[model samples]
Target: MTSIGIYGSLGRMGQAIIEVAPSLGARVAGGADAQDDPAPIAAKADVLVDFSAASALDAHLAAARAAGTPIVIGTTGLSAKQHEAIDAAAQEIAVLQTGNTSVGVNLLARLVRDAAARLGGDWDVEIVEMHHHHKADAPSGTALMLGEAAASGMGTTLGEARVTDRAGLVGARAEGTIGMASLRGGSVVGDHTVIFAGQGERIELTHRADDRAIFARGAVRAALWLAGQKPGRYTMDSVLGDAVLGA
Candidate 1:
């Protein structure tokens, strides 16, 4: 069984992981919170799952690197600099980082990408996501991930194709661009929908997350898969495997 360590042990996701780990044939090596030192936990576990704040990402990555342990990061709201840090850490220790750990969400991303590729630039892409009111970020990380998938299919980058804010008098929707809208409300676990609009018709792909346990289940599965891998950066798609992608 994999020995799993958790960062942000007190958070909802962390608690969910702890609850589900044993059933998945894993043991909790330990955990660390904001006031706790993660190095010790990192050193002792076969793999580490991070659901902590973005500000603490550097320290957690450092700890994982120092201990030569694989890490699965499910933290959201990461800045470009933090992503750079993750990339750097990946050079040494195996790193699997994703905006959302739900297997359904990753599979949704793949489908979005495939649809974008097949539909071509003639289709306008827009992603709308809703999360719980307590969620702090706008255009939730998973929204951006879906946008990136559509952009990748269209052979453009999200930075170039993404249009997040559109208010009154924004003119017509730009061609070949991906739009993102975020909503916050009461106790919504998560909801994402990708819309593709063309001249005569429209296609929509959606995924709804009803509970946090799904994320925890996926994260543990990712940690188990990552534990045996060599040092490198990975994504949830890799965890789902190429067979699923082909399917």
Candidate 2:
């Protein structure tokens, strides 16, 4: 059986992963929390999954790297420096990182990319997302991920096309720019919708996550796939494959 270690073992996502492990053909070898040392878990498990705070990322990545264990990072709100660290660690061990690790979400990203590419500049692209009230980070990581997909299809990066905040006198929406809006209320698991508005018609693609199990399953799937791969940086798209939409 595939043994996995979890960072942020006390958090909601971490607990969800542990709960869904058996059904996903994996077992929880152990876990590490803010108060605990992650080294033991890193040394014991076949692979590691991090759903912890961005502040703890450095130590977790270091532990995994030292042990030569593959790790899947599901934590959001990471800085560019942290991303660079992940990239550096990928040179020594397999590393998979994502904003939202839901098969459906990953599949949705594929669809958004294709739609943006075909719709051309005439069709304005917008992404809207909402999460639970307690969730932090505006626009959500998933929203940014989808924005990246849309931007990629538009032959640009999210950094160039992303429009997050809008105030009075913001002026007309820039052509070719991808807009993002965020909502937080109640106990919403997750909801993301991408709108493609054109002159004559509009197309909207959406995905709703009712439970955390979907993300847990995807993380497990990534961990399993990472185990056999050579040391490198990987994404859910590669793990699920370009043909995953049909699956």
Which candidate comes out best when scored by lDDT? 1
Model 1 spans > 4 angstroms off = 243-247
29: Cα error in model 2, Å: 0.4
In candidate 1, position 211 carries an lDDT of 88
Q: Identify the runs in model 2 with alpha carbons over 4 angstroms from their true place.
A: none
173, model 1: CA deviation in Å? 1.1
Best by TM-score: 2
TM-score of each model, in listed order: 0.97, 0.97
- Specify the poorest-scoring 10-residue window by lDDT in model 2: 238-247
Global Cα lDDT for candidate 1: 0.94
Cα lDDT tens digits, model 2, 60-175, are: 99999999999999999999999999999999999999998998999899899999999899999999999999987787989999999999999999999999889778999999
Local distance difference test scores for all models: 0.94, 0.93
